[model samples]
Each structure stands twice: as C-alpha cells, then as structure tokens.
Target: MKSYEEINEKIRAGRAVVVTAEEVIAIAKDIGVKEAARKIDVVTTGTFGIMCSSGAFLNFWHTKPKMKMQRVWLDDVPAYGGIAAVDCYLGATELPSYDPCNSHYPGSFRHGGGHVIEDLIAGKEIKLRAEAYGTDCYPLRSYEQNITLKDVREAFIFSPRNCYQNYNVATNCGAETVYTYMGVLKPHMGNIHYSSAGQLSPLLNDPYYRSIGIGTHIFLGGGEGFVAWPGTQHAPFDPRNERGIPLGGAGTLAVIGDMKQMDARFIRGVSLTGYGVSLMVGIGIPIPILDEDMLYYTTVEDADIQAPLCDYGKEGYPTGEPCVIGSLNYAELKSGEVDFQGKKIRTAPLSSYTKAVEIAETLKQWIVSGRFQLGQPSQLLPGGGSPDRKED
Candidate 1:
C-alpha cells in the first residue's frame, strides 16, 4: 500500500502522478484500479455551487475608543457581532435591513451579506457600521468606517456547511410558480434544477469519507483551505448504492481558509431572483491514492450517482415535509433533458461543471508542481462505510 509520506515525497521530487477525477475515471477504466493505483498518486475532485451556510469571520481590530460591538452591519447587511470586541461573522444569506422580502409578491433581493463578502475579496472598500453600549473599559458607543479585506486584522471563511455529497433535484408541482433557492421553479414541473458536479464532486469521489476528514488540505476559492469538521446536519448514515455514495444530501464539510488569499472568480455573490442573496463558492479536494481501493473509489461515473427528485411547492419542501417524487441519475440529468412520469422536462444545473473541471485541474497542477501538499486527516468523519462492500 502507498502511504501519504511516499506520495508526498514523490510530489516534492516532481514524480507523483496526479490527475483530475474525470481524467482518472478514464484511466481506471482502461487499466483497472489496481494497475492505475500503481501508476497514479493523487486524484483531484471539485465542486462549485451555492452554499448558503457559508460565512466569514472578520476581526476589524479595535476602533479608536475600542468599542465592543453589540450590533454590526457591513454595507447594510447585518452580521453577528457577539463574538468579541471587534469580531463579527458575516453570513452569506443575511439580507439587508431595508430588504422588503416577499412583502410585495416576489422580492427582488439584489444585495446582502454575500455581496459584501465579494466586494471585500475584490479589494473594494465596504462601509462598516457598528453600535454598542458604552462601557468604562471601552467607551465607544458607535463606529463607522470603510474597510477592505486588507483592513481587517484577521479574516477567514468559516463556512459551516458546503460541498454536499449528494443533493435533491427540485421542481414545482403547485398551481403557481415558486421562487426558491433552487431557482425559480416553473409550475407543473416545467423545469428542473439540480446542483453538484456529479462524479467530479469531491465527496462522491471519496464516498466513505476515508480520505476526506478534518485537517485535510483543499483548494478553496482559489486558495488553500482545510476541512475544519464534518458539516452541520451531516448525516453520513444514509441510504446508499453499491458504491457507498449517499443517495441524498448526506456528507458535508465545514471548511475554513484565509479569505485574503481567495479569488473573486471563485467567491461570487449571487442574488437568486426572489430568494435572498447567497454565496457561490468553489472547492476542490485532493485524494491521495493510498491503495487500490482508494483508487477504485475515485473511478465513480455520473451514471452511478443518484439524486432524489422533490417538489419545491407547498405540498413538498415548503411545509417542512418532503414529498420525494423519485430518483434520477446524473447521466440522464446532464443530457439537458429528463423524462419524469413519461413527460420530457428540461434540466438545468445550478452548479458550474466547467468551473469544477478548472478547479480539479488547478489542484492537479498544484500537486504535480510541488506547490500543494496533501495533509492527512487528524480525525475521520462521523459515519463510515466502504465503497467496495456490499450492503446487507
């Protein structure tokens, strides 16, 4: 079996064979996993999509009079200022105070916390305003200033949930059109929307969480990051196919990295029509070929990955209860059309497959050029299974 140390040594010496997840699939198909494992050292996987649970932590340093911020606003988007003297957490889904959400039919939410984040990463100045109760030690009652990402003493993305292993395909079955996070779902199932890079998704490549765990280094928003923990609501013990990949939103990652090193292209702010604003972040993970089994797992194709179809209307996702219509594989979904109940419907991918490919290739280049080194996880994720094992 190949060890991480061995692969890292090769990477340093510029001898480790690295390939994107898509590329390795063909290689494994041609030469088989055992032979491919002997020839390959690492497989890079990626996903780029909307992750609403994303946010950033910023330490704006102390104001002139040292204010303990009780409430904070960045570009009118509220932030959680309960952390420290000058620390705040800006969530992607946080809307502006003036945002009249759904008061008049469908709201046109054009700006929010996500936009503020993008501006900061873009090296643009953002208006920062905070208020506090005057204390003897720190007497400042209010503070307002313009700050960029460079102005913050510390700034890093602390996304609580991202890179869903597998997610649902959303459609509308109600009488009227609905504007949901899945996008504007047409009534009577006129359209379908699905996110995830299918086989190129990081968790899909490492289905069992064997190689992806806490402390594992990854490419995040064009910079390096690490898996902080298993994401919120992480239910790894879900129904799976023979390949051990989850059938629905199962495994997720809580990741973090320096926001200063991030790129504006990968970290974009999205205003989802009637829905609130959210962040679309890019993430990529490199799985070291520790053995034949690890190499084999990376060979999963789009046909093997399945997503549950659910209605996004009142009878479905809105009532806190789900009505699972059925399941569809990625191969059929990616073909731009799908047949549901004998009716052909158009399918659109919210996630960017092209960007995912770029992320994977970029990570592969990093490893090959000895610019990136893989880090072993200090702890495995919550639930565990084997892709090679048969479900009893």
Candidate 2:
C-alpha cells in the first residue's frame, strides 16, 4: 500500500490521477481507512466547496499528499434554484419578484429574502427550514476534469488579520463617503471652487491657483481648512495638518451631514482603496463586522445661562470635559448660540487595522479548523427588493 505522501507525490508528478469515490476508498485503505476517510471527507465536501464558491483553487503542481483534490466529471448533478430553500433558511419572509427578462430574483424585504444584513443579524444558530417543491432538487454542474482524491482534503486555514484589516479601515472611516482622487483624475470634482464673484475661472485663473499649484504649501501657513477640537488640534503649520484634504492627491474629502442621507452621495465619489490590495495579497476572504454595544448621549442647555446656548466653550459647555460630537450627533443654534449634541466632542476613534487583522486571522483559523462557518445565510432580503409582508 502506498503511503499518503507517496500517493500525493504520484499525483503531483502526474503519475496518478483522482478517479472516484471507490478509488478514494482504495487510497484510504493504503493509508489506513480512518486517515483515508478523514482526508476524503475534507477534500470532497469541504475544500472543494470552498474553492468552487470562492473561485480560488490550488494548482496541481502544488498538491500535497494529504491534500484533497476534486475531479470534474462530464456528468451533471441535480441542480435546483435552491432559492426557496435558501429563502426559507435565510428567514426570507417574502419572495423577490422574479424578473423573467433577467432571469434574476429581485428579492424583497421579507424575512427569507436575499439581503446580506438579515442573515448576518440572524446569526449562525438559526435552523433553516427546507421547503420541497419537485423531484429535481437543483441542477448541479460538473467540472471538466476529475479531481485527485488527495486534493479533496479540506483543512481550515486561518487567514491573517490583514485579510480583513482594509474593511475595518474603510468602515470606520466612512468607506462609502470618501472620494478617490488619484493624481490628475478628480472624477467627481465638485463645482470647481467659485470665487466671491461667482465666476468660473480656468484652473489658472482660480483665486487660490497658487495654493492648489505644485508645492504651493498645503493647508496654507495656518491650518485654515483644518477643523478639530482643542484636544484634537493639529500643529499650526504642519503640512500634514491639512485635515479634510486628500493625501498625496489620492485621498478623499470629508463632508459633514446626516450619514444616512449622505451615504449615496459619499459612495458615489469614493471607492474602497484596500479592496485591490487584499485581492492581490491573496487575503481576499470576506470578514463580517460584528455589532458592538452602542454609545448614546443626551444634550441640555447650560442651566445657568439666561439665554439657552449650545456653545461648547461658553458657560453652557458641560461642566467637566465637553461631550464630544461625532458622526452621529445633532447640532442647533438656539438664541444665536451654538448648541451641540451627541457623543461628547472628541477625536474620532482610531480603529487599528492591526487589531482588525488579528480578529480576521482568528476567524480564518476557526473556519479552517471547522470551528466556524463562512457566508451564513440571513432572513432579510436584499435592500429595496420587496416589501415586508406579514403572514397571517
């Protein structure tokens, strides 16, 4: 009986090929049935599925003896829309209107719809109820070549934290709103800075032309465009103090408004920078953002002031450290005094990509070890897919 390593070497050397379930059992007999069974299960069911779903595969030359391989047969497996079953498991309470023209399900907001959020919120413990429709489950497609039995071994590998670090950065920094300003290409350049005269001048005729010119000194002598609280203040003359300006002419501009209302506008101008980076580095696994406890705040005018004032620094400012304003805050001017409300005004929380990467790596390890599952189904439908229907 050939050892597992020996069989693997033969496959790599193109001396042997993956055949079928029976052939796999034969190989396992050589390496001990228990070892063979474990390898077969991992390869055929675990690894193959992942590769197929993610569209990533290991080359044959890189095959290891214990590694499982998949073979494609000309035969097709039973394939179903799996839509109804998926919807049921996902808690899709409503079905998307089927678009015959597109052959796509335009899902709805019902519990079993195809929305990613619904599934995420549902968590992994939810048992999906399968709904049967016909004798044919679903049409399965076959691969063009047979897989090596060894190549089918599925082992959970932990991805590094860097795999998900980019997502963390983008999400924390308002991924949808940041504009991408690559070099001379300002795709969504806003109403080219109008002067007091409201005249649209050529780039050369612009009032701050020199300010926008090469080496013209960003942020001016004083960090005029920069805005931050006293605790978060930038150096008066530091070039890097140019807050809200793009970095190296390849960053985004910060816009202040209600996030929900501005989400679309922000997404329009910005694209995720770390997406390409992650894919290139082979850390393209998707990582989910967990919902942590939320922090909330309440605002009141200074009790002592005769006129209600919202000014943070005025007598109305909270007694101790002033409450910080954040992306979620509300501000109003009452009686000509600025009143601010939200999480106390402070420096935006610095989300460390390093920490995010660590968590992601841990998740990957869990997945590889069969301790975790990826792409959990949800009960919610895709956004704007369908109206929430109450079933009696």
Candidate 3:
C-alpha cells in the first residue's frame, strides 16, 4: 500500500504530478482512466460556500486576579462561556444583539459572531467583555478589553459541521416569496438557487469515504488542517447510487485549524438578507491517487452529479420529506436555467465558483512547490480517536 508519507516525499522532491479536479476530468476522458490515474499523483478538490455551523474558539490569558470568566462577549456578540475559564465558542450565526422579535423587525437582525471572526482574522482590534463572580483563589470579577487575533495565544475555527456532500436547488412555487437558509426563493418559481461545486467538492469526489478518512490532510480556512471527525448530521448509511455517490446531502466534516494562519481572501463574514449572518468558508482537499477506483470517482463531472429541486415556499418544506420538484444535473443547473412548471426558471449559485477554483489552485501550488506537505492522520476520524493539538 502506498502511504501518504511516500506521496509527501514525492511532492517534496517535485516528482508529483498534481492537477485540479476540473482539469483531471478532461485529462481522464482524453487519456483514459488507467493512463491518467497512472500519471496523476494528486487530484485537488475544493468548495467555497456558506457554512453556518462554523465557529471559533478563543483562549485568553489569565487576568490580574486570575478570574474564570462566566459570561463572555466578543465585539458585542455573545459566546459560550461555560466551557472553561477564558475559553469560549463564538458561533457564526449568533447575532450580536438579540432579534427584536416584533412584527416590524421581522428577520432584520444581521451582525454577529461571524463578523467578529472575520475582523479578528483581518488583524483588527475587537472589543471583549466578560463577567465572573470573584473567587478566593481567582478573585477578579469582571473584565473589559480590546484585543485582536494576534493578542490571543490560541485562536482557531472548530467547525462542528461543514462541507456537505450535496444540496437541494431551492424554488418558490407559491404566490409569495420565501426566505430560507438555502437563499431567497422568488415567487412563482422565478429563480432556482443551488450550492456545492458539483465534482469539485471533496466529500462528493470521494463519496463512499474511501480516501477521505479522518486523518486526511486538507486545505482548511486557507491553511493546512485535517478532518477532525465525521461532521454532525452525517448520514453515511444514506442511500447511494451504483457508484456509491449519494444523490443528495450525505457525509460532512468536523474540521479545526488556526484562524490566524488563514487568508482573508478565503474567509469572509456575510449577511444573507433574511437568513441572518454566516461565514463564507473556503476549503480544499487533495485526493491521493491510491487506486483505480479512487481515480474513477475523481473523474466524475458536473453533468454526472444530481440534486433535487425542492420547493422552499411550500409549507411542508424542510422538515417533511420535501416533494422533490425534480432532479437535475449541475451542468443543467449551472447553465443559468432549469425547466420547471412548464417554464424556464433562472438559476443562481450561492457558492462562489471562482473562490472554489482559487482554493484548488492554491493547494496545487503548495504541493508543486514542496511547501504543502501532507500528513498521516494520527488516527482515522471520530472512531479514530481525538487528534493531536498544537499551537501555531
């Protein structure tokens, strides 16, 4: 069995032939799978989309009286304070202020933890406040200060769930418009919005988790990180096609890495009109050409991928088994139109395709330059045991 260590040595010595997922698709078709897989050493996969489950953990230094923070706020956005002294989890969608929750204020709340996270990553000053009852050994009761990502000893995004395998295309067939986390759906089936980079998504590329096991080294938040666990809501048992690819959402990833090491270009805080705030996260994973089966899967294309067109405007919608309007290939979806209700419905992609390609190219350069060396996962994910932690 060829190991990741061997591949890293090859990459370091400039003997590895790396290609982006899109490029490999054409190469595989032209040269045939056996020859293309024989020549290609690594295939880079990428995705750039809104991940609301994202959040960051900030570990602060001990205060003057050595206070253990019981209440915490960063840039006016509340973070979970019960974890431990000076440690908190700032969720991406958590609003800076509570929603007014009145008829006039419906769905207007915006600024939240995601913005603060982006600012900190940008190396800008951020306000922090915490309150704690005085203790005998750790006496300080409360604290207020302005800090930056540089000021902290530890700062990393510990996203519990990200990079879904596939997603539905949203449409509105009702008389009025509807707002959803999937993006706004215009009334009368006016527009269709979908995400996931079709063949470029990591999980989608290795649909059965054949090569994307827990310890796989990946491009994360603009820096190198590993898949920590099977992300929450993971349904590995979901039905799959003959090729083992799930027709819709399947595997997810729990990833963690230094926020300070990430690039702002691939990390942005976004406000999704009626959907509140979220992080536009960029991620890339390189699938090693371990075998012919892996190679064949990586060659999958947008035309081969499929997702259901679920009506977001319908009342049963999300919770119930959505009445799939229809299934369509990403190539059809990306053509900027979908056939629906006897009319052509325009389409839009919520995920940024340009950034997704940039991530893949960046990872490719790292390998070609011998700068991004791959690591053997200490163990496999979730069941593989916890990963080793280190400070950047």
Candidate 4:
C-alpha cells in the first residue's frame, strides 16, 4: 500500500492523474480498499451540452517529468455499487416557468426545502419534507433531442429517487458531470419557500437570499459580503436625509451611530476593511455619518489666493498692484482690520467640533480654485439624507 505522502506525491508529480471517474476507481482498486478509500477524498462528475459533438472527453497534462499517467472514471458501469445512480439532469424545461424578476419566490421555496434536509442532517429541527427538481430542460424544438426534456425529467426523478428516499428529486438530467444535480439540489431544499397556494415560491426579497447567491457564486462566506455590495449596487443611506440638511452646507450636522451595530469590530483603533464598513454598505444598512459639522463657508485665505498668483501671472486681475500679497497685508487691505481674515483662516484645533465644517469650506475653495474636481455621487442631494427628519 502506498503511503499518503506517496499517493500525494504521485498526484503532485503527475504520475497519478485521475481526471475521470474510471481512473479514480482504477486507482482505488490498485491502491487496495482501505488505502483507496483513505486517499481518494471525493469523486465528482460534471456535464456540459455539446452543440455539434457526439462524445465528450476529459483531458489534462502532467508537467512532472517523473510521472506520466492518465485515468478515466465512467459512470456507465454498474459494478461500482451504482454510485453514479445519483446523477440527475438539470435544464430550464425541467423547472417550472416562473418570472425571473419574481423568481426568488420559487427559488427560495426550492432552497428552503434543501435547507430543511441540511438542518435534519445537522441534527436540527425537522421542519418538512421539501425537495427541488433537478432536470435539464432545453428548448423543446432545439436541434438536440437526444437529451430531450423527457429524458432529463425521467433521469432526474428515477435516478435520484432510486438512490435515496425522502430526498428531493431533480427532473432535469444531463450527462454525468461535476457537481451532480443531486449534490447541488440537496443543499437547496432548506431554502425553498412554500406559498399560500401550496405552490413553491422563493422568498424573493430576503436579503439573505441575495447574500447566499453572492456567497455561493463568489465563494465568499458570511464575512465576504463586502464584495457583494459592488455587485448589488446597494448604496448606504445618506445621513443628510435623516438630518434634513445638505452635506457641506449650513445647519448640517454629522450623525454617529453605534459602530457595533455596523458589525465593525475595532482593532487597535483601526477598523478592518471587510468588517464594519463593508457589512453596513453591503446590506444597504444605514450607518452614522459623523455629521456634527458637515458644511460651512469661509472667506478665502490670503495664502490660498496668493499661492495661485505666484504660479500664474496676475494678468486676469484688475490692475492689482501686487497679486501675490502677504497674508498680513492682504487681511489688512481686505478687512481694514489687522487680524480679521488672517486669524479666521487658520486651521482649527482637532478638538473643535467644527472639523467637518472647516473641511467643507476648504473643499469649496479647492473646487473654486480648480485645484480639485469632485466625482458625481451615486445618488444626488435630493436623495442624499434620511427623510425621517423634517426640513429645517
């Protein structure tokens, strides 16, 4: 018997390449019952529809010079305890016609059935006997009738039903392929939702449904919901709406909510990228935007105005004696007071509650000076803040 490392080395070195089920069983037989069962973790089949082909083949290359072997695993044989008996078909025709927009109702219904089965296997509550149909139904009049809708439907019902009882059966069967229909269907029954009419309908609007879809397709577990946000295009609620004030304007204030509610775990004063902000934004949940001071306007500083004059000739200025004047002189000339504008333009202390206000004023100045340009918001000001608060 080969050791685990020896088998793994064979696999890695390309000496033992089990690309097909036949190869897998062959290796299993060669390695003996105990060793074969231990070494071979999982054997899966995938099916694809061919447009102009009659036979499909699996191919791979072993780059390792020391190992060169190819193996195939076919389900057509019965000696393998008919393990391939679980294979089912999946096609559009096999599934009931439901509006894709409202398809969630049916999808959820089917998924809920699968979920129940999972819960039972996990020793949870035994809710109900729910199952999903897995039969590949193609367009009836399409060129390929060899794998007809009827064939898929019969394959799903009889094949899976024969292998296991109480499990949902798929009515859409295709060729044995990776991730068999039964393998995919079992987990989904728990997710299906039953309607008042006793018909299966998916829980369409549930955020969990979207999360599951995203999690499955992208292989992102619960925490990976961040990537789902960009795909869903869900935008965070604007605090300005709730406060009845525009951001960067007078009377605007920041709103701070419990960061914990946002699922933001604090780590050494640095919020991890995927935790708090991602969760809040991904699910379209409203979060507190520090709105204590979001907007303010202030007189342009002498440093700001003079800095530009030094870079560009004062040709546009109306006969200015000196465009690039010092701060003290500019303040005195503009305000007729020594410390009026100059003192007001200085950066405020960090302890000040008006930091947001101060920043808004600076941002405005920057925009006016053409030093920066702002991108368009995902949504506009009218939809900017929460609408619960009355306009001030």
Candidate 5:
C-alpha cells in the first residue's frame, strides 16, 4: 500500500499519475483495480451545487468612536452580529428584513446574503449599515459605509455543511405545485429534480471517507480550503448497497477557505424561483490511491449510485413526515427522463455535471503541474466502516 508521503513526492517531482473520477472508470475497466492502483497516484472528484448551510465571516476594523455594533446589514440583507463588536457572519439563506416571504406566494427574493457574498468576491462595493446602543467606552450609535472584500481586516468562508454524500430526488404528488428548496415541484408527479454529480462527486468516489476527512486539503470555490469537521447532521451509517455507496443522504463536510481568493464563477449567488437564496459552491477533493480498494471505489459509475425519491408537496413534505417514496439510479436521472411508477417523467439536475468535470480537470492540472500535493487527514470521519467492493 502507498502512503501520502509517496504520493506527495510524485506530485512534487511532476511524475504523479492523476486522473478524474470519470477517467478512472475506463482505466480500471481496462487494467483492473490492482494494476490501476499501482499506476494511478490520485483520483480527483468534484461537485457544484447549492449549499444553503454556508456563509462567510468578516472581521472589520473598528469604526471611528469605537461603536459596539449590535445590528448589521450588508446590501439590505441581515447578518448575525452576536459575536465581536466588528465581526459578523452572513448566512447564505438569510433574507432581507423587508422580504415579504411567501406572504405573497412565490415571493421574488431578488437579493439576499448569497448575492452579497458573490458581489463581495466580484470586487463590487457593498453598502454596510449598523446600529448600536451607546456604550461607555464607545460613543458611536449608528454607522454606515461602503466596503468590499479588500476593506475587511479578515474574511473567510466557513460552511457548517458543504458537500453531501448523497441526496433525495424531489417530486410533487399533491394537486398543487410546491415551491421548496429543491425547486418548484409540479403537481401529480409532474417533474423530478436531483442534485448530485453522481460518479464524479468527491464523497461518492471515496464512499467510506477513507481519503477525505478533517484536515484534508480541498478546492473550494476556486480557492484552497480544508475539511474542518463532520458537518451538521452527518450520518455516515445510512443504508447502503453492496458497493458501500449510501442509498440516501449520508455523510457531509464542513469546510473553510479564504474568501478573498475565491473566484466568482465557482462561487455564485443562486436564487431559487420561490425558495429564497443560497450559495452555489464548487468543491473538489483529491483522493490518494492508498490501495487497490481505494482505486476500485473511484471506478464507480453513475449507474451504481442511487438517490432516494421524496415528495415535497403539501401532503407528504409540508407535513414534515418521512416521505421517501422510492429510489432511482443516477444514470436514469441523467438520461433526461426517468420511468417512475410506469409513467415516463422528465428529469433535471440542480447540480452542474459539466462544472463538476471542469473542477476535476482543474484539480488534476494543479497536481500535474506540482502546484498542489496530497494532505493526510488528521482524523477520519466517524462511522465509516470497511468499504465493500465487488471482490469482497
């Protein structure tokens, strides 16, 4: 078995054999896992989709008169200022106080926290407003100014939850169309929307979390980042098929990166037609070929990964009950249409597979050019048992 040190040495010498998860499928098919593991040094995987459990932290220099800011807003969207005097965390889903959220059905929440983040990264000037109760040492009560990413003393993206290993395919079964975070679901099983890169997804390639964990270096929104911790609601013990791939949403990741270094293309503001706003994050992770099993896992194809089907309509989803009706493989979901209950239904993906491939290629280039190296995870994700492969 190869170690991380060996992989880095190869990368540094510009002699490493790196391939995207998609490319590895063919390599393994031709040479078999044993030979593929000996020849391949790393496998790159990527995903680009809406990650609502994401935000940024900004540390600003104290304003004149040293006011302890109590309330904060960036471009009319509210931010959490319960921490330090000049620090605020902007959540992706936080909307403006003025937004008439669904009070008028299908509210047009044009701008929110996610847009503010993208504008900041794009070097656009942001209008900042704050209010504070006058303090003994700080006399200023109100403050207003325009700022950009460069103006902040420190800024970073720290997401509580970023990449999900798998997720549910959403549809509507009720008579009325339902507007949810998965997007608008038409009534009576009218349409289906699934959001995962399938075989190219980082977690799917390393299904057991063997190569991805806390302290693992990653590409986040076109910038370098690291896995921070097990994400919120991380449940690695979910039911799985014989290949050890989870059948539903299972493991997740918490990641952090410098916001100033992020690119606008990979970090975007997404406004769901009726579900407010969220950040579209592009993330990539490189999995080291530790053994034949690890290389074998990376060979998984879209046909082998399955997503649970859930109803998001008023009857099943709105009632908050567990509503998984069935399951569908990614190959079927990506085929432009799927056969659900013997009725042909149209299918669409919320996640961008093309962008995912681009991210994977970008990462491979980084490794080939000796610009990036593999990092050994300090701690593996909890609840990951032995991966079951075809040979096993």
Candidate 6:
C-alpha cells in the first residue's frame, strides 16, 4: 500500500503530478487505474452547494463591565448564547424573526446570521447585541456594538455536519409548486432536484473511511479546513449498491476553518422563497493516491453512483412512508431533464457546478505550489453511528 509519506516526498521532490478529480478520472479511463495510480500523486475533489447545517463561532470581544451574554443577536438575527459568557455560535439558518417579526417582512431572511458571517469575511462591520442577568462578578446586563472578523479572537466556521454522502431525489407529486430546501419542486413531478457534486464530492469518492475521516485537510470556503469529527447523523454503514456508494443521505463530516481566510464568493447567503435562509459554502479535498484500490475508487464516475427517488408528498419524509422507485445515476440526474414515472421531468442543480470546478482547480494549485499538504485522518468514521429514534 502506498503511504502518505511517499506522496509528500514526491511532492517535495517536485516530481509529483497533481490533477483535478475530473482529470484523474479521465486519466484512469485512458490509461487504466493501475498506471494512473502509479503516475498520479493526488486527486482533488470539490462540492459547492447550499448546506443547511453550517454556522460560525464568534467570540465577541467582552464589553466594558463584562456581561455574561444570555441572549445574543447579530444584525437582529438570534445567535446561540449558551456557550460562554462572551462567546456564541451564529447559525446560518437563524432568522431575524422575533415576536411580531415572524416572516411578516417581504424578506425576513435577507440578512441573517449567514449574511453577518459573509459580511464579516468581506471586511464589513455587523451590529451585535447581548442581554444578561446582572451578576456580581460580571455585572454588565446589556450592550450593543459593531464588530468585524478582526475584532473577534476566535472566528471560525465549525459546521457540525456537511457534505452528505448522498441525498434523496426531491420531487413533487402535489398539484402546487412546493418550495423546499431542494430548490423549487415543480408540481406533479414535473421537475426534480438533487444536491451533491455527484462524482466530484470528496466523501463520495472515498465512499468508506479509507481516506477521508477526522483530521483530513480540506478546502473550505477558499480557506483551509479539517474534518473535525464524524458529522451529525453520520451513517457510514448505510446499505449501498454493488459499488459501495450509499443510497440516500449517509456518511457526513464536521468541518472547521478560519472565517477570516474565507472569501465572500465561497460564502453566500441565499433566501429560499418559503423555506428560509441557507449558506452555500464551497469545499474541496485532495485524495492521496494511497494505492491502486484508492485510485480505483477515485475513478468512480457519475454513472456508478445512484440515489433513490422518494415521494416528497408525505410529511417529514417518513421512512418507508412513500414508494422507493427505481434508482437514477447522477449522469442522468445532471442532464437537466430525466425520464421518471413514464414522463419527461425537468431537473436543475441548486449547487453551482462552475464553483465546484473552481474549487477543485484551486486545490490542485495549492498542492502543486507546495502551499497545501495532506493530513491523514486520525480515525475512521463510526459506521452506522446515528440511527433513527424509536418509542413504545
């Protein structure tokens, strides 16, 4: 088995050939996996899309008199103040909806915590406020001020979960156009939308924890990040087809990176018509050519990965509640149209393929310029780690 040590040495010697994931696949198809594995040192994968489970930690500088923040708000959007007296986690999905402000405004989510984070990264200022019960040691009860990324000691995006290994194909069987997170679902299954960069996703390429896991280096919103933990709802052992790729949403990752180093382009705040706000972050990871087996997995094409078509008509998308029709490979899914239920259905990607490629190319340049180095995961993901809850 090729070890990471050899790959670093090859890079250091300037003899390594680092190629984008697409190029690696093409090389594999042309020269076969064995030769491609021997000749290539790294294969970088990328995914740029709207990930709901994302947020950043902001250590708002302590105010005069030292207030123990019990409730935090940024540009009127609420933040989780349960962490530390001066620290809070601003979730991207946190809206500005207060008592009378419950989505009554034309665009409630136009400026959310995600927007604040984006503004901070863009070197702009954001208003911050906190409320606290007066304490003897820390007597400041309330405060209001403006802060930027530079004002915070700890400004980083610690996404609890991201890059779902696979996702269910979203479609509408109802008569009305449904606005959900999976983009706008046209009525009567007239259209379908799927997330993930298909073959270009890092975890999808790894499939198993063979390469990707905690401690793995990655490209996060144009900044370097790492896999901090097995993501929330991680299901590493989810049943897969013969190719070992998970069927629906499966294995995930918890990533963290410096918010200051991020770019506004890679950190966008989007407002869905009815669903609410979400962050579209760009992520890229380089897969080291550990061996022939790893190379073979990296060569996996869109045709090999498949997802289940779940009926979105049912509430909560309950397990086995709706019919599980035939599987559709990403090749068919990305065609902008597909045949489903004996009718032609239009398809679209909420994720940006152009951004995905840009991230991939950027990561490739990092490795080639010796600016980025690969890190081995501390451990493998917990297979079938999180399961559904049951009751009597």
Q: Report the C-alpha lDDT of model 1 over 1-392, residue by residue, as the tens digit.
A: 99889999999999999999999989988998889999999999999999989999999888887889999999999999998889999999999989998786588888998888889999999999999998998899998998888889999999999999999999999988999999999999999999999999999999999889999999999899999999998888889898887899999999999999999889899988778899999999999999998998899999999999999986899888867999999999999999999999999999999999999999999999999999999987887445544434
Please list the residue runs of candidate 4 whose C-alpha ends up more than 4 Å from where it truly belongs after superposition: 1-224, 231-392
lDDT of 6 by residue, 336-376 (tens): 88988789988777888888889999999888888788898
lDDT over C-alpha atoms for residue 52 of model 3: 76
TM per candidate comes to: 0.97, 0.17, 0.93, 0.14, 0.97, 0.93
Least accurate 10 contiguous residues by lDDT in model 6: 383-392
List candidate 2 segments past 4 Å from native: 1-187, 190-355, 360-392
Candidate 3 error regions (>4 Å): 98-106, 318-321, 377-392
lDDT of 2 by residue, 155-255 (tens): 11111111110000011112122221111111121111100000000110111111112111111001111101111111111111111111111111111
Cα lDDT, model 5, residue 156: 93
In order of TM-score, best first, we have: 1, 5, 3, 6, 2, 4
Return the clash pairs for model 1, or none.
none
Per-candidate total of colliding backbone pairs = 0, 60, 0, 71, 0, 0
What's model 5's TM-score?
0.97
Per-residue C-alpha lDDT of model 4 across residues 243-354, encoded as one tens digit per residue: 2211111111111111112221110111111111001010111011112111000111222111111101213112444332222222222232233223322211101112
Report the C-alpha displacement of residue 274, candidate 5, in angstroms: 2.2
lDDT score for candidate 1 against the true structure? 0.92
Better of 3 and 4 by TM-score: 3
N/CA/C clash count, model 6: 0
| lDDT tens digits by residue: candidate 3, 1-392 | 35677788899899988999989989998999998878888899999999879999989988887988998999888999899888988999888665552234336555787888888888899998999987797688889999988888898998999999888778877878777777778888889999988889887777767667677788888887878888998766655566666777877889888888988778888877666888988999998887777788899888888888888886637558556878888899889987766799899999988889999999999999998877655554332211121222
Each model's lDDT: 0.92, 0.19, 0.82, 0.19, 0.92, 0.82
Error in Å for residue 362 of model 6: 0.6
Question: RMSD to the native, candidate 1?
Answer: 1.8
lDDT at position 391, candidate 5: 22
- Residue-wise lDDT of candidate 5 within 1-392, one digit each (tens)? 99999999999999999999999999999998999999999999999999989999998899988988789999999999889799999999899988887788897778889999999999999999999988898778999999999999998999999899999999999998888899988999999999999999999998899889889999999989999999998988888898989999999999999999899889999888778999999999999999999999999999999999999988886798999999999999999999989989899999999999999999999999999888798988886536642221
